[model samples]
Target: MAAWPWKSLARSRQPTDGGDSAAPGKLSLSLSELFVVGTWFGVATGLLELGGTLAAVKLMGRVTYDTLRTNWHYFWMTPLSNLVLFSVSALVLCVATARIPRLRTGRVVFFLYAYLTAWSLVSAIPTLHKTAEVVLAIGLACVTTKFLTKRRSTFLRIAPRAAILGAGLILAIAGVDVYSTNRPVDRGPSVASVAAVGPPNVVLIVLDTVRADSLTPYGAERDTTPNLARLAREGVLFKHARSTAPWTLPSHASLFTGRWPFELSADVGRPLDSAFPTLAEQLADRGYATGGFVANTQNCNAWYGLDRGFDHYEDFYENATVTPIEVLRSSRLGRYVVTSKLAQAVIKRAAAPVDFRYRKTAGMINRDALAWLSDKGDQPFFMFLNYFDVHDPYQPPKEAERRFTKAGGEAQSAANLARDAYDDCLVYLDSQIGRLLAELESRGKLQNTLVIVTSDHGEGFGEHGLAGHGVSLYRSELHIPLMLVHPTRTPAGTVVSEPVSLRDVAPTILDLLDLGTAPTFAGKSLANTWSASAADRDFSEPVLSEVDRADHVPAEVEDAPARRGRMRSITANGRTYILNGDGREELYDLHDDPEESNDLADLADAQEHLHQLRELMEQVTGVQENGE
Candidate 1:
């Protein structure tokens, strides 16, 4: 309840020209002054942004470094937007200040900044009063009033600087992106005599959220993966198929580009950067028909530029016609309370085709993939399936959950039960897999074609206080099931203990297809691990994972925004992981803490292991120790 000093100062005001002032009659808010208000708004927006982000982190438990760096991005992304908003705010405030007004612009702006910053801090902290956020928000209005009254000249200088900094940062990142990406790698490795017109149509099925161990073939309790198990008996089942990332985008990116998650992680929301070649693109160039069906729009052709290689590149699922009520219930308050109406309106407009079902509108995708074969239009085919069933809001139909857990919604409400639902979804996915496999077989293309079954990452249903992923570096998050089913693979029904990452998938697929070798590929081919002798087996390489949002993890409550996805740690050999979060680095031996409950970072015995892992991560990612 700070009193407005600026308003009092203006009460007994006199004109600079010593003329008879008309009692500051009607407050005037012009278009130009409004624009300046917007300029001031740009300066103040960071505080509101900081508040929102802090609240998100408080609820989610962690925030990635890159997202925090988005502040660095807003520094540029919204200049014109700021102009429009500030212009409007300024006009209204000016109009009020002149007449029927008790508000001061400069005072209000200053108070708002203070209120928002304090509120965010209070929200982020677990201790203290619960009303901190409300108090802070109310206090901000006074700050805004003060801010609006500040001399117009200071705003002029600040506005341009803010815009420039953001723009500069954006340009710099773009330049680096251009250099890092742009290699035309996928195009270079051409297949010799690329088969055309039904040379064993290949179906690369990607089961979203499908874990390697969930299948009964892998000794799970439920017959959840009946179809996949049957396929295992008929074809080669790679006991170990690991995805490079714990999330969908990077994992799929690795599959498409044969790169590791760390390398491809930055490519999320962006395409494959046009430098790398995709299997579909490669096949299309060689007169092969390429088509894909996916359940999620994030994995669509448009966002990631995946539709480039196909002639009939159809992603009709963009506008989901049907939606579930469960999703409606799951919406957050913030979704409606987007501080700005424009932002809220934009979100609503874009979300017209939103879906909350276990099965998205994927029937069209299946039909399209199947159609590619029906036409058999004088071309070989490379088909793909992206199943998004296993992701969050794990709704596996009420009946399926009943089969696994005794409790219904109550059980499914728990993390472990959701995992059970995920398993059910996997089972359903397997049935779909069966249908695809049968179609391929009916066409007489099963024997000669290479079948690769794998996941982007595993699900973590409250494995460690964490309900889902993008939070930790635990084995539950990183260790994935990787299987490669080939027509003439000599090592059938064989279990390989060698550690593997999703990075090698690209190179392995290309190798099998008689395409070019992966010179720049950081992963070793699984075929290499299947050496005839199997005597000298150092089959796996040190695997690295990162979560730039340190505080996003439960373990990192303090020390926010350290190293943006720098290097949380690495899993060397297969057992040890040297983890870095919140400025402290720890070592864990999976031999002992498979649950990752124990820390061995200080253990003298782990010195060599830790050194090697750190070195390995540094070499691949180009990230180093703070002092070093």
Candidate 2:
């Protein structure tokens, strides 16, 4: 039987199959032992992974079990899932390796450096503990394969039944322990809050890839969001509203639950747990008719459960080429596997690319949304409408594209010039909003309706090393525009600059209608802001922003010893932390370098500020003593 890998790290009492002492006076293990260790490590890690993830479902939903088990699903993550997985794998490997006596003592120094590097990465993308565990397993396998001699490497050799039985017993105990951790309970009265409105109609519109500074009301260079501008001029606008996480899933999750991405699964790739009560869920329980109309394929994934609380969720790009996963799946393989593995493979390839590419212009999504809207019959509804026309593949209508290219933007890329098309789409969406408003008015429901318009974090336009969104947490990603067009009784033409978080939106809405629920929500209400003047507002520090990019593991080659690992970021205390894939930290003062063009790690004062911000960040992200 092959001895465990750790047994080979140094000499042990066990003899090698070769019957020869592998090394001199120092004890040594045969190569076969190493392979066994790797295999054992991999199997245990995979099981741990399954167990840990199950726990995540509970953690995210803040639930033990279901009352009826009607709709129990999976975990949902935002953008940095790959990064989270990588970090978590390291932590898992760390614990597993500690069991190896020879390997444990000999690689103390090496393990310390490795673990610190791993911890730094794991902390950034907090949800990927499973991914990290897997990576560690793979790491062991890789090392074992590289060192083991071909002599005993053949698969034909098998461990004796007794030894195999022992290993299996250990594994079974480990799995059971993990399973024991999950004690399913009944939160019969699952929720404690309800919005106190006569079921006032709630309309949440998320404009995908909309840049923060692009709208005229926000002092943009162009009149891109004229319709939104009109609404801002007459409604309440949150001047410093920031998204909790980048990308669609995480940001949207925050928007719905008023929580940060890390608090949930954090692996935007996985399915979200349904136990948590989102805003829509709350409203639905309150007897409001709920529905969702989404244009982005990213928002319509099964894992996200954006359709969790809605009764009628519409997928508009059905026959269109706009469905992101389907398009990618088709590109990788063929249409035959459009809704399967091919789609998933394509998504990773397209998203995690060397550079980036642009596809269509915006308006198509808006048209679909409008089509869906034309059929609505008001029943005090809670409807979510997300439009991705402003997102990349910036192909605008030819006329709009021509208008911009001919007027001034001819020098831009196909995607950029398509901005006109995007602008046109945004305009169309606004017009559609206006139409909806008119419809409500015609039905005498306009005055009582509560309209909230926001972008799910803004897009990046060639700012840092990226374009569009999903790269960093700068003003571009977190600083989105939010407007509340409530009943006139709530006030109007108000702009709140009070450092409001997307996490606070749910509480704010509940509070607005005098909903008798505890205001335990993370976001503060802008309802009162509608009655206050801009100068009277106190927004201490811009809204907090974070971009944990730990998962982008660069493809590496063995011969080339310079492949960097991954980077994770924390932006607070006026300094932006740039953690590189190579396990290096870079600090930049945003006040000094708005574009983040310089690293200020050596600045003593800057480091002091960084220290403070880090403190606040940990609290905001909720690192409780209870291990939440």
Candidate 3:
């Protein structure tokens, strides 16, 4: 082979006062050689840390955090970030030693790198206590550095070869990761027996974490969702739509399967199982092409089993494709650096266009969706789009922020600021929705399409002492907007006031399409309420919302009434009865006390209503008073 690329670096030597560089006690290395060695060592250490962490996560099967997921982008980003960091550190060390004659930069830098590498490797062993791991790493690194320094020539001989091997391995792994993640999803065979013809295409858009009351169509004073208001005017809006759960997975599970939350495998740590067929599966089986594009990658991704039946599903960092910033966000070190307070401050500055989080914007999602729609042929398609911008850590675009919220100042409380930002996000989401609708109209697809706009669940902004979803079954978290728009089918401007669960979404879609109800679905078709020609128009029905104690609740408040155990509620006859996890019962007249401040559980007149609701709940959910 041609001479090794690092031959000069390996042979390079430094002169000392004794002049004989080969002297046993006077081992020295040139600044350039030291620079190369230290930089490579740092890069190798980073790669080792990342590889070890990934291997541990895969082998253990317990580290299931979204960040640790094996996204292809992380492979390249983590090692690259480490390389940059280590190279810069090496440069700094080399410059310092050249300037300050007394500083033994080579040994100090090598020792520091060894210690850090050891620490990183040990940290991958999740079973070890952090203190013990650190101590062991330091001890090991000290011994290793001492041994190598004593045999500098031997170490120099091996270092270059080891670094080259490491570089090769990194490239190999990166290539493999890219190939694996980007490979086409094998959609074995088309389930459709015949191509769909006249049935209206279904476009279900879920505005995640959007509460009904916050939208202008739901009586909010602000015009935050003018587009939604227009859609409401052109569609049938369910004024009292409620989600079956207070969070994403379960609520979405209910929406897709037409079943209750307790009946599904979806939970804080678990994903929806195949026990129930999704709406997409039902449509796909009946000659409809299905596609799901979701921005809530944390829970709505394929990892969570939400992409079960879709021929194509797109989520954040999918297909081994990612932007530069997305790659940074996917890496462990880059995640820490990008999410640091200083970096966040810089990103959130008014002049900066950077997003605080690595979420796809609604515009981006819409563009992808529209492109997919363009490719769809004569086969009626069922498309599911989830917009996550309205969820947490609200950072709205500059224009929307200016339009909705007052300038950030000391006068605005934290809650006010958060709510304002949330509204800003809603406005941005609405604008995107408007754009999607306009695109559909321009393409002559709007008239033949059945557009459904709703949410998985609502967000809680200090309502009923709840700040976010999944913590409680309060109205703030359960009440979501539901609207259906179809040119020739659904009656425009029709407002249905009856309480309905999101479970009805699947059944209603099937019912309107004349597909009938699936055997497993527990929800009733909502067509009866909107279709005048139907025999039974009575819309009165009990709506149930359930929530299990979420894992994110702090330990200090684990026993808090709202955060304890499982909570369930049933709304019927304009009254809602809540069975709290702590064995407390609450009853509220939703018509008169929509705020749920007045508890009628102990009232003599309310006992009869509570008893009836308890029976209804037990009959519907098969769970008794003590929450079996």
Q: How would you order the candidates by TM-score, starting with the best?
A: 3, 1, 2
> How high is each candidate's TM-score?
0.60, 0.56, 0.74
Strongest candidate by lDDT: 3
Scored by lDDT, model 3 comes in at 0.75
Instruction: Assess each prediction's global lDDT (C-alpha) against the native.
Output: 0.54, 0.51, 0.75
Q: Among these predicted structures, which one has the highest TM-score?
A: 3
Q: How far off is residue 301 in model 2, in Å?
A: 3.6
Worst 10 residues of 1 by lDDT: 326-335
Please identify which of the two predictions, 1 or 2, would achieve the higher TM-score against the true structure: 1
Q: Which window of ten consecutive residues has the lowest lDDT sum in model 3?
A: 1-10
For 95-185, candidate 1 gives per-residue lDDT tens digits of 6555433343333344443443344333444444666556655555545444544433465456556645644554465356445544333
Per-residue lDDT tens digits of candidate 2, residues 63-125? 121101111111111111221232344355445644453443313212232333333223233
Residue-by-residue lDDT tens digits, candidate 3, 365-441: 89878767665656688999999988887977555545657755558777788888898899899999999998877
What TM-score, to 2 decimals, does candidate 1 have? 0.60
lDDT for model 2 comes to 0.51
Q: If candidate 2 were superposed on the true structure by all CA atoms, what would the RMSD be?
A: 15.5
**Order of the predicted models by lDDT, top scorer first:** 3, 1, 2
Off by over 4 Å in 3: 1-72, 79-199, 273-275, 284-289, 317-329, 334-356, 392-394, 407-421, 520-522, 531-542, 554-561
lDDT of 2 at 205: 79
